[model samples]
Target: MTMQRRQFLGTMAAAGAVLGAPAVFGQAKPRVVVIGGGAGGATCARYIARDSEGAIDVILVEPSEVYYTCFFSNLYLGGFRDFESLGHRYDKLASDHGITLARDMAAGVDRDAGTVTLAGGEMLFYDRLVIAPGIDFADGSVPGWDLSKAEIMPHAYKAGPQTQLLKAQVEAMPEGGTFCMIAPPNPYRCPPGPYERISMVAHLLTQANPSAKILLVDPKEKYSKQGLFEEGWQRHYSGMITRIGPDFGGDKVEVRPEAMEVVIDGEVERVDVCNVIPGQRAGAIAEAAGVTDDTGWVPVNPHSMASRADPKVFVLGDASAQGDMPKSGFAANSQAKVAAMVIRAELSGSKAFPAKYSNTCWSLIATDDGVKVGASYEATDEKIASVDSFISQTGEDAALRKATYEESLGWYAGITADIFG
Candidate 1:
């Protein structure tokens, strides 16, 4: 066996031996099984391991060997970044932090038994569990569209092969052909994501197919960074974009992927390329764990990010329904640190402090033109309440916008290192 595989197997065996033993017996260190290796799970595993000082055995179960971030994925579509640049591996998480990497999907969670069954059929017992599987599209959210139709109409929301497929389709569009985007509703992953994608697509079209048009079908009447994006669109690519909101039947729409058509209020429109971002819910594992509510997201205690249903299980990132936090990578990363601290304190007798969270979402409107919105939050009895907020103002000078864009680049580097290493 490879050295890494042997190490992982050894860790699993050790954990299995202590499945019925109490930590008070001091036979084995407490074990934490984190499902998902995105910003939330990776950060949580690293912090729990590093802070516990080997007092906790951290096992991260993730199917993907290399994680591609959804935050800057729009830049990849715009040709601002290469696909490889968005991918991050887990080697450092394993080697530097002594985290056990189980490259397997979590198929089931037995809350009563405190065990997680992997797709490969290995059952892992955990003293504590963290689920941060991120977002999954809701079935039947869009008529005539499903996962099977994804090949024809790419969503590109998860930031991997779908992203590459969407970008390729955009680049291959016929000159002056129309491109359509079906934006998702509220409470979806990355509130500003679809808009940022629209801006990126516009950037690409302006350069290669100047005559091409963009059709934005949005269900909501307003969106994140609306004024700023509208100003940028007008200034950068005037007369090249059109938007249909709820009043104009954007909310009542269906797609015929086979025919390359979008039906809005019974009006049929043909497009060369279609990007369909359907409504989304917590990743499936959350539901399997019985933590999610009717809203299809796990309600977390604002104080510790522990699931309201089961305190032993904590939910983070897009899978959690923490109040006032948008489902963005930055928010997920921030929530993960808080959860890690709390989990360590609970299991390892370490000091725990009040939980504070913050999030900022930055979007690139054009070359070196960026905008942002963010807020600071604190845990309250009812929810994670927002304390203060800020947003990039419209009509900013080129120098300021360029500086904002540069700041985002630095943030990407810092956050990725913070997450992976």
Candidate 2:
């Protein structure tokens, strides 16, 4: 179900062939307005701004000045790395790539008028629009769970303030304190992200307070890298890790912040730290723009990523419903590249050839050891199917594990360079 990193590059090489010879078309550069400067939006902005030379005016709207990657953020929360390491600057995207970075959220979109409104009431028009605002939690799904409760329990999955709050709670916990984690339903961002987090926290507690344990409430029977994660836990903190599954009692996952307790089925919660990775919907911007269907996700063409409802607007990353692909940072970054290339060709009056996309997500199970999964995608009438994938072995090999750790840094550096420079 997953593709490995090495196989992804090979698939891309083959993809260019099936796409036929690249066609050349002549046209003036068109202005691009990109909303959300996360992995997907930022990468698209940089490529359009740079490849179009001085012809294209790229404006990027993002509320935050700096982006903290969600890929290895668990390491920071576990105390294995500093927060600064995950933070990235946008100077290259602005000064070097000539992208006009707007430091505000896109309040509304007037599709009929072809204009977008900023939170400050500023209006901007674009020849083309790219929406990649990441994800928003389904706050209505669970009863009595809202932003206020999120402030207390801290989902840290978003990789910003939540990450800091979780770290602080862990640091202040008593030696024998229990840490509770509530996993969301299937089809969410970073499928293996939560398990990797548990692995890192177990590693940290082994040093800081070995008596502490993690109480996991999983909505599904099995999850991404389930076998590998269980093997690592057995070798590391087998007894300290107690997992509750749907059959065993995972259905009881719910929380009350005022009581500072989470109920499992009908049981009272008792934990010093808590994290609930809630179910997710599309980003609020997508809903406001009326691009989402009942599921709150935009529908798009599998090849060009053009919205089915709106041709001038393209949806990428977690915001779009890309069949069979996980909602992941790497996937978003990869999708951005493909979407940008298609837009480039479209603006030049050239036809969009069938393009292939691939993504690999690396999760650090410990300081020197990491696990990864990846997949390659191709367009079809039914849906996108996996071309290839790879996964790390259960028990780590001395050489391979070390290479994965190095590869993680290489990935971060490469993606950052591709997006910013």
Candidate 3:
């Protein structure tokens, strides 16, 4: 699936007397098309516009009028943030930064014709393409899950309607009922995300319905910051939260939407509210474009972010299976800047300096505090690997808890600036 027709052409292009072998040979301000302006595409568009010296025509394709990043949406769910705070306008990305914004989804890619077809039936020709369209649920990965009834038990992974749907269910949860969270296995986006979400929601339920319980149905035996997370949960929530791991209860979901029961071990555990975050795969667009890996993530050159299938394309963020680097808004924003620099060098007929990268992800453990993970990295033969890292060491005092709380907002602000502000 990975070997492409361009390998021979690329080899000849490298061997021949071409002034520029890697980038567009003679195009001025290479017209680049970017899909999904959420975390990766928006940041990439902004950087290309900000630093490309007007030698790149940046066009962003997105369907949403405003984007609410999934990373910070937990804050909104915790009642710490107004819904308005999470909304980001694309006008700044389009108007201030000179990026051409398209409000439509990419429907098809005619690579040989250098065109990307839009959901509206418009054909956009590009000198180069960057796809950061994020992930999609593997259709019916579990027996009871399907598009027809995703409305009943929302994933909240998309962070808009899913957010609202899940919120309504949480509010409607009976005073002493159960709320369950089904966490997908490893290689999923935002490794530490769902646990942090359950933590925040559990905190909310502590007040709204003190007798409420949270059941975490996890596929994996362990999770990101497994030790730290459990420590925090036990200290704060204790009996309020219970997790079922692979060995004891197993992770498979035999979903029965009509009855609202997720079967495990031949038993039906009906819940007042269910949040099933199923196994994920690259957005179908990546697969359709023929850039996906065996695991359904895009394969790109670690250094250039160039697709192994089409060198003219660069894939970033959650859509690309960049190991070690968690699929996160911060990571996407960081990679966006790097991809911009590499594309800039290609446009200028120069090579980008050895790529060095950084990422920090902050998740709200509760309204009072947040836990963080951060790392600096460089590309390796296989993928972008980390050089330095930090994880939350137990929060010691009230002042430190306050500090962690404020730090999440600061990180969100700084990352928003990096991407769209």
Best by lDDT: 1
- Name the best candidate (by TM-score): 1
Task: Compose the digit string of candidate 1's lDDT tens values, residues 1-421.
Answer: 1124445556557755753333444578888999999999999999998888888988899878899999999999998999999999998888888887887789999999888888866778888999999999998888999999999999999999999999999999999999999999888999989999999999999999999999999999999999999999999989999999999999999999999999999999999999999999999999999999999999999999999999999999999988999999999999999999999998878899999999999999999999999999999988999999999998799999999999999999999999998
Worst 10 residues of 1 by lDDT: 1-10
RMSD (Å) of each candidate, 1 decimal: 1.8, 9.4, 7.1
lDDT of 3 by residue, 1-421 (tens): 0112244235324643321222254634467789888788888888887777667777787878788888878777767777788888787876677786676789998778777777766566676788988989886666787667779878888888788788778878998999988888767889888888888788778879889999898879888877768878888788999888888675666778778887886778988888888889888888888889788888888887788888888888888876678888888887887888888787656557887778887767765666677899999988899999987777466567667778878888888877876
Question: Residue 284 deviation, candidate 1, in Å?
Answer: 0.1
Across 1-421, the per-residue lDDT of candidate 2 in tens digits comes to 1112334234425753311122222433466889998889999888777766756667787878778888779888777689988888787888887777666789998777777787865566677789998888987544446767877788787888888888888877898999888888876889999999899888878888899989998879899989888987887687999999999679766787777687888788778888878888888988888889988788888777778778888888988886877888888888888788788776755455686888888887766777788889886655556788888888768678779978988988888777667
Candidate lDDT (C-alpha), each: 0.92, 0.79, 0.78
Assess every candidate by TM-score: 0.97, 0.91, 0.91
Worst 10 residues of 3 by lDDT: 1-10
Please give the RMSD of candidate 3 to the true structure.
7.1
Q: Candidate 1 or 3, higher lDDT?
A: 1
Question: Candidate 2, clashing residue pairs?
Answer: 3-374, 3-375, 3-389, 3-390, 4-389, 4-390, 252-265
